[model samples]
Target: MKKIHHAEASSYFIEAKDNEAFHDQRLWDLRQKRDREAAVIPEFQELRNLASQIKEHTLTHLAEYLEQFEAKAQANGVTVHWALDAAEHNRIVYDLLTDHSVRTLVKSKSMLTEECELRPFLERRGIEVIETDLGERIQQLDNEPPSHIVVPAVHKLRGDVAKVFARTLDTDPDNDDPNYLSEQMRVKTRHFFVDAEAGMTGGNFAVAETGGVVVCTNEGNADLSANVPPLFIASVGIEKLVPRLDDLAVFIRLLSRSALGSPITQYTSHFRAPRKSGEMHIILVDNGRSERLGMEEFWYSLKCIRCGACMNTCPVYRRSGGLSYGAVYSGPIGIILNPTHDMRKYSSLPFASTLNGSCTHVCPVKINIHEQIYGWRRVLAKHNQLPFVKKAAMKVAGKILSDPQKYRKTIDVADAAIEHLPRFLLYSRMNAWGRQREVPAPPDQTFHAWYLKNREGKQ
Candidate 1:
């Protein structure tokens, strides 16, 4: 597959300015709410600092903690599995379903599963996998990937959702009412909950001390999926492990407040062991995370709680939308992490950001996201992964910037081009940056010229 550059893909999003503004407003609203919540807590920054320290400690002793967690979980009768990559993760889940003769499986919102493409992997093997989360289910039915990590359907308007329901669920065609649509989905999801032979959830955090997987959700889908079925599987990233159960107090305090501006999610459920007469499994997936740990400068990206406050605060993410990044993870963190995972595949991601550093300030874990993105740009350039057009532009810019006389002459020419050139000539297909944005005309005279003409005379 030809990878779409961030600029090219984001052009489609930019063309729909109205939709982009709507999306931007919604996310900014969440950002404002988060600010409100932070204002009330005198210890908010202290909590963030403590949480960062706990994550740092946990990651530093990750191997030891993982082994201890496995031992404890095994003692509690929860089978533990480790996957080195996405393929292994998918195979393990499929093997478990086949062994149990599971025809249907219900799953809560799991970005890890999406990362592994587990749904299609199982479906191709003749297993029915139903998404239990309301947002996830909507995307599943629409046969599309999520646009946002938290609000998966954020790109869709209410009318768009209503039309989807009308076509898929046979609901009233004109009914765009939120309460009615939710009730309709509620009525249908209950049936899937009962019929599923197995259920799966993604853990927000794994408590190493208690052999517990903690899941937080607003819709209670994670709890329903885990409890209704006889067999339960929790797919967790290796980075999700916290050393102690008491640490949940710090994490839980920041999670919803940062992500949705709520005091807490509606459900904060912890699974310590298998239910009586039921089977439980935990799959620990590394999938490049172990390698990421060794990267000194970039390793802190693992501290992310996935609250998505960075995305909410990112100017590029708000304007361009998540789909433009062309990766499972998006925004500032995605720009850094995606390239770290596979630079050849996602080299363009680092260029997607404006390097404003807003993401670092809003991060609950204090990932230096913008700085990492800047670092990735250098890495990509060293490897000669930069696009031909960008390299040419940079080469010319470098030469002009290095010479004062050349710079002034170039500026004069640019001002002339802006004033005398036709709009089509300046904003044509050749100009990637100008394709979706207006190129402001430079001032008619240079600052140096004005300084000599006016400032010197005034003096």
Candidate 2:
């Protein structure tokens, strides 16, 4: 049986108390850093506006741009392949690897691979996949999907990493020093870069004018992934495409500042063709992107550049932890993206927010994230995807609030219960709100009663 998102988030919140606090503070720190970085750029808002327009223009003319990209890539001596969905994307990757007779494949962090479930698909067919990105490697060894996109293992402490390394890499579990752990991982995986028969990377931006796949990484691992092996492949989502190389200026300015509070990524590699003697292939994957584009309320989501800014600023995401979303994408972005992929599995997500609008404010591409989340709730209710208990409760609450006399009567009854009822019954399993939060002490008197008392004399 699938546990609903509310249950999953509640369990994480209750059990990971230490991690929960750290996660909240740490992400808030990132949010602060983002604000500081944004403050320095005099044209920050202007860049965001330009980026949103560029994306909207590209998406509206997506077909023409994609065709232009494919043609340019082909002209640049690159083999271009298209996949309509995840299964096809996986198959295309598997065949390409098998064709090159690759046994051990070294890959950098590619959410596209995770979205396509490519690692397991290849492993089942006797391919050994090595994750070259440190965070990705940690999650891989632990047998978990990445918790956060930019920082995949952000939920874990250095101590947790020491334990994971001890179990897998035979390092000292007690020595949780960051430098020692990083060096240990580096020394252990260095050979995979040289020995692997092939390498793969995810594209951050695909330029249609030059037909180049641009990847941004802080670690420089993506560069090694693309250049080291004789056989190279880049898995790029179609939405990552921009019309011209110059248009990259706007996104390049905003991407890191919004994501990690850095001026720019350490490595912004552009790959147009294979190396002198090596071969290269690019997989342009739709994977439901085209269908999502047709959705009027949600099509703006495609403008996302995977910055994770909204995630950092989101109070619910910071407190609940990214894994609570139980999907490839998490946080505000996930809340909107997951439902379109699977309504039944992710219907609880839209309701996970406070509709705070903080996410919309922080978005580099200006996506109306909170409004979209609210829109999803309406969509879910219409489609009967909301859970039975919630549907019934909303119905009752609607009735009570619609008529003023009934509302006042219910409020009086609730005030009496909170004031006089036993603690056990007041906070029993039946009270969902009380489960995660303390119900405030009953007011000295109902506001309505106080208003009647004071305002009666004034009138």
Candidate 3:
């Protein structure tokens, strides 16, 4: 597998000045809003703590809670299925759709289904899958993966969206008004809500106590997707389960505030059973989550609620774009999560962060994302998964740092190179850092030399 070259991939997003400027500022604005909303709530941090603890407890006792959830869901007239991996997850959904004679499926925004690549799977088999969420539908029409989790098409400007709609939805390309675009999207998708044979959703939180799947959205598409179709399906990641309904209060408070700085979503629909006289199915998907749960350094990442808080606050993600990660999940969370699934394919992802810890600080679940990224780097190095150049450089760095004389000599050489190297040599393509910035001029004197002069070699 070709390793994900994040720098090379992100160059495209960065080169687009208008899109890059908007993407960076828009996400940072959301981060500011998150901070403001968090400040007003006295118990915000406490809720995060409680939510983290609850998730830890639930994960440790996952089998018991899963069994309880299955029993209760079955009791409530919902057919519950389990998937061990992505292939099984896809097979189960396909079998279910075929068994029910479902030709067309209308689906709400579902990251789990995206992870399973369900749309392409079913479409290849001649089943039509329509995305109902505004952002997801735009991305689907564009034939691109979402650039951000909460705001999938965030990298696109209104003009770009208008262009997309003009090409596909046949909207007036000159009419780029937000309201007009939204209305056009609504008008186009309204029929699918009624005409589709099946509708699918992904749950934000699953309550083991009540056997209910909770979906929170600003748009009410999930509501329509779950309620309008005679055959309803929800694909839930196994990590979404909570021990009881009361535990929902903590996450409910944090999800919106952390994600979009809203007090709550416009619609927080709870699906406990099928619509009257309709059939409901819930697929509790593992898809490498069980393996992640067993990992010592990385398991707590499962505490994620899919709120996109870390992505909003991540400077690297804001600049690089989610598509740069080349995974269903992106940003800080993806750095650690993607490698677990395919180390060779995603090894470069772990090194894509600046380790600023803004993602961890902003995460409602307090995932310690930067630390996990660091851990992934170490693990990748140990497993020989790092790029050959990086691996060799790191090996040299390790040797130099282990010996004081060698380290000092290397620093001296670097200082000389910085001061005397010609611009042509220093700013060449080989120097990735110099692409966007010139290497800083050599210091007036090396810090090491200054230290020696001041302390008179006391050590």
- What residue pairs are clashing in model 2? none
The true-versus-predicted C-alpha distance at residue 434 of model 1, in Å, is 5.9
- Local distance difference test, candidate 1: 0.87
The candidate that wins on TM-score is 3
TM-score of 3: 0.94
Q: In candidate 2, residue 383 scores what lDDT?
A: 98
**TM-score, every prediction:** 0.92, 0.94, 0.94
lDDT of 3 by residue, 1-459 (tens): 777899888999899999999999999999999999999999888988998899999999999999999999999999999999879999998998999899999999999999999999999999999999999999999999987779999999999999999999999999999999999999999999999989999999999999999999999999998899899999999999999989998888999999999899999999998888899999999999999999999999999998898999888999999999999889998888889899989989988998999998888888889999999988988898877766666566667668899766656555554644332233333457665676666666667788877887677
* Stretch of 10 with least lDDT, candidate 3: 420-429
The root-mean-square deviation over C-alpha atoms between each candidate and the true structure, in angstroms, is 2.9, 2.7, 2.7
Better of 1 and 3 by TM-score: 3
What local distance difference test score does each model get? 0.87, 0.89, 0.89
lDDT of 2 by residue, 42-125 (tens): 999999999999999999999999999999999999999999999998898889888889999999999989999999999999
